[model samples]
Target: MSDFFIDIIDDDGADQGQEAEVVSGSSSTWKIAIIDDEESIHQVTRLALSSMVILGRPIEFLSAYSAKEGFELLSSDDEIAVVLLDVVMENPEAGLQLARRIRQELGNHNTQIILRTGQPGYAPEEVVITEYEINDYKTKSELTRTKLFSTIYTSLRTYQHLVAMEQSKLGLQKIIDSSASLFQERSIREFSEGALLQINALFNIHSEGIFCISSGPLAGDRDMIVAPLEAEQHRIVAATDIFKSYFGKAIDDIDDITTKQTLHRTLASKEHQFTNKYICLFLNTPSQWEGAIFIKGDIDEERLDYELLSVFAMNVSLGLENTKFFTQLTQMAYYDMLTQFYTRHGVIDRCLNTAVKNGEIFSVCILDIDYFHEVTESLGFEYGNKVLVSFANRIQSILPADSVFARLHSDVFAVVVFDDKPLDMEFIAKQCAEAIHVDGDKLRFGVSVGVSQFLPEDNLSGEELLRQAEIALKLAKEVRRGGGQAFTPSLATESRGRIQLLGELREALASHELVMYLQPKVSLIEEGTVVGFEALVRWPHKEKGMIPPNDFVPVAERSGLYYELDMYVVEACCKILSEHSELTRIAFNLSANSLNRPELVDDLENLLARYGVTHDAIVMEITENSMAKGGIVIDTLERLQSKGWLIHLDDFGTGYSSLSYLLDMPLNAIKIDRSFLLQLHDSDNAAVLLKGIISICKDLDKKVIVEGVETDSQKAFAMDAGADVAQGYLFYKPMKLEEAVDLMKKQS
Candidate 1:
């Protein structure tokens, strides 16, 4: 074993003890290896270079005696910057062979090699330097202290440059990889966070920093760069390292005064600022937004290439612009502008991503605002918008923080709850029921809600959940408005049945399976003489037999099929009038939806002309609710009345039975609903209400037809009440065309 000792040689050739600096404690150090068989060579070299510091780092020496040991030592520490090898150690060509192994076997092209030899005759310096990848070659006798120091200095400098170049290459590659990822981010905050991490990796620094932005047009204006700003204008969008907790805070809220000042200067100047202790990079976006990243730590100027940083900054700016654009497009697609709630598409996406995809249980509730059109029609649409906004705010206030609320249609909104517990639908209903104050007026409206649950066991998609909820909503509106219902299997079955029946009804209309049945309207003052007949629609299915009107009428009304059905009824009545002249003034009911059609009068005129039926022979019966609609319905009635058709208000006491409707509508007669008659025998209020309705119709000079008179008492009450006509089972059941024609002949 070779013992190591540090002996400094003087000019007199006496050895002197020299103490080496304590460089082992330094965080930054340059590692060098001395591979030689002679212990004296190691001692002298260590004595000479022990006090040397290059590039602000102390030198760390590693010793290996034999060529094999040197190879092992170099293989273990690739960071060894410089290697000094002695020729003729263990063998004449051992140093040469080890050099080849270091470069070829270990693939270490970085460590600088210096060769020293005592036998210049054995190995020529030029040949050895060229073939062995040696940086410097010297004879031992020629290597004075001055030459040794100069050679070591040059080799260390060369090694430093090579390492820096390699680091630069890696950093640039990192920037390229990071730019690709940053460009893919569609969120500004996410992109900023990723950019901060990449910046840290690019410079190989562990520093605290924040990414901040000032938004709006003024932020991007070059002229406004130096203007005084509000403290809250600069928002910290992302943070890294110790500044992670500072995210979303304003720049002024940062505790570090120096960091805040530097960031403010960088943003105000719209330029990059680099100091000995920190770095601030200003980023410009295509939008009216400016941003800055403040890194609080010393950066090596050698690694901080201005050109590379410019390229990186340009990429970050493009990424920010792309993120902003995509974010805006996303908001427009997923959020409603007026209410700032999620749109229908947004709600479905949330359900899929946050619940259904994860197999989590959730529930969906849909709300339809009843009588919404009246608000828009009575007030202006702008005022109606305020009401909708108020209603949305109320709903949002009552929902859980995690719930997703959205506007699905003009008057329909939806809520998606993530919890597995049953939704408190009554609470939602009560919240929505509160009156909305719009423009100093308390506008009251009813909200009908339908709810459905999503269970992993059910295996339903988000759209299917919404469909089920809508089915329940339709039932709520039909069974009773201003209430809520949860989805049941029976509702789905009924919906499917209605859908099937609607298809069949369309086919029936085309095939003429639907026919008009008439019941005689007898005059009470004329000793029960038949004056006219009320036409009713009846469907006789080829296989299922006669289907009652009640079974399909509501279905048609809900499905928007009532218009076609009403037109069919009108044409049938025209056809009957043309065929039998004795059957005159046949009255058929028109639905509220049918009355709102702009072409109703024109279509009726065409049908009458086609059948050669006069206008006086046909009567149009609309419900009291149709009169209450008051806009298109009233206009349509007036147009028909002006064209000489008799208009009768049917089901008067059934819906919206306001006396104002009797005065406002242009009606030739009013038919009391059978519901009033059913109560009249048992309740005195029913009799008094019926009497009052008939007296009002008489005072208005409008004829009164009493419907559903089944027994003698009902018939006597109709005559005593001075009703102009009575139509019931007692007079004649709704009969076929032949029976009706025979009855008309008998009455004549």
Candidate 2:
């Protein structure tokens, strides 16, 4: 051991019989405990710290004779900010034990401990400093006054930093708690209000703010709205104390034009703006829903999350997005895509909520554009869309805001008007129909309205109420009524019978109970030789007798069951071809719905393979309307032709019979519609049209088939027009497979 120096230190760490210099700074003292067995070490520590000050605070040293005494002092009083200790004290490892006790047992991690050793080799300073949690390691002789004061100042600085961090952590926790509470609010108003409050709490600063939304879809072509309406549409969803009265109000409605322009500009740029007057953070809500927070204060947000308002702004954005999405989803659940009016489902929802539950009198008027199909046929779909939009705008504009208007079906609008007293449904229907009849350009097309009233004592569901309205609509259209017809019990009975017929029809097709009848197509050039057969589906009902093709085909097509019916006919044709080798080729008709189905190709492949039939044995007769379905349908025809199937453009004289489809499609034949053959009796225009069609087909190297040849004159007319084949009742009416087989065998 080095020769020990002795100098006594009192309890207050004052040197005995030695005057110590004092610092003049009047600040709180940093209590530093000196733990050592040697009195000389404590005396030297006190002398070094005697005139020293850190952060304007004077240093105070507490003297301990041994490690045990230092532990007792630190345990009783937590004010000791630093410990200057000797490792080899009363016990060789006593200082080490006390350092561990002060840090671990006393849990005084905030205080700094320095380990001093008289004999440098007694214990390794590095090991003692690390294991015992000592802040600094120094031998007694090396601890000069300047070095000791520097160490104490450095340690004091570290302790002050820890306390400041603790304060910040508590403050951050408060903000987290506030932000977490915001999610529970459902509406945008409540959510933004909560978020604004949290932002204020985050900074502990008072500020005014508002949330605005620019309306549009989150993810769609934003151009759906007219450009003029884009900037004109925005609303304040929430606001601070200053703008509270304007919550849920449109931005345009506010008198503050400057603020409105600022908001619009901010929404347009999608950027945050910060200045002394205010800081604006754009909350990027999905779709065109533009929202932001405007804080009116000079805030130094360095203590908070560096971008303090951004967090609450983001929360408000997400929350408002969720609420708006849900709101739009609710609207869409009951509204039409094109008109922004309620659909049939929407009307039903309204009825369930109000009309059905209350005793108030309400009438539903079902209106339709008269001769709408002709409108679409004469003009293209673009013009038709314009017509629909115009009609919806006119009707909606004329009706009271309280009235529920919905697009119940294509070209049909259902309006439910509410009245306290009993409604004269007929007068109401007439007035509504006249409104539509004079409604803009739609007046040229005219309109028919059907009125239905809720009958007392009959608890009707929304579906039943709408069904009654539909009955009236059909009645008015059929009768060509001046305005509309009111619903009657007889119409409901008729509708029920139709429904029953539809159900039976579906069952008959599913069970293959319906029979396939063939109408012979004879070669006009050969005079009597049978060339091919047209397959026609016949529904022979047990009770109702033979149901006319005119009856169920329209109903089936209207109800979206035409594809199934067409597919069934194709399957029957394939089966007939497979069953009879004499039947060389079968021509069958397919509607627009069947043609557009993407699965048609796959389904055809599977059906042909299942029946072991070749594609060449089948002829697909598509209507003129199907040709207008654009390139996809034409492509399908080409693909079918490539696979050896013959494509015939049936009803070729009707609809948009563009020379384009005739040239573009892989057509094998053009079947003249019955209208052209019938029209010949009225004028030579029919003869001229038929001859032109045949000449076109001839030039294209395609076959021509004339239908509706009922008399010898008509057949002669067709042959003269260069028709290769003719099929009509005058040759042979539609016959079942057995009859057709016998007729074919006789002819053969």
Q: Which is the leading candidate under lDDT? A: 1
lDDT of 1: 0.79
lDDT of 2: 0.72
| Tens digits of lDDT, candidate 1, 617-673 | 988888877877787887888888888989998988778878887788888888998
Backbone clash pairs in model 1 (N, Cα, C under 3 Å; residues 3+ apart or in different chains), count: 0
**Candidate 2: pairs in clash:** 218-287
**TM-score of candidate 2 against the unseen true structure:** 0.48
| Candidate-wise lDDT, in order | 0.79, 0.72
In the range 590-686, model 2's lDDT, one tens digit per residue, is 9887878888888887888999889788888988898888767877877777778788889886888787766788888989888888888999887
Which residue pairs clash within candidate 1? Answer: none
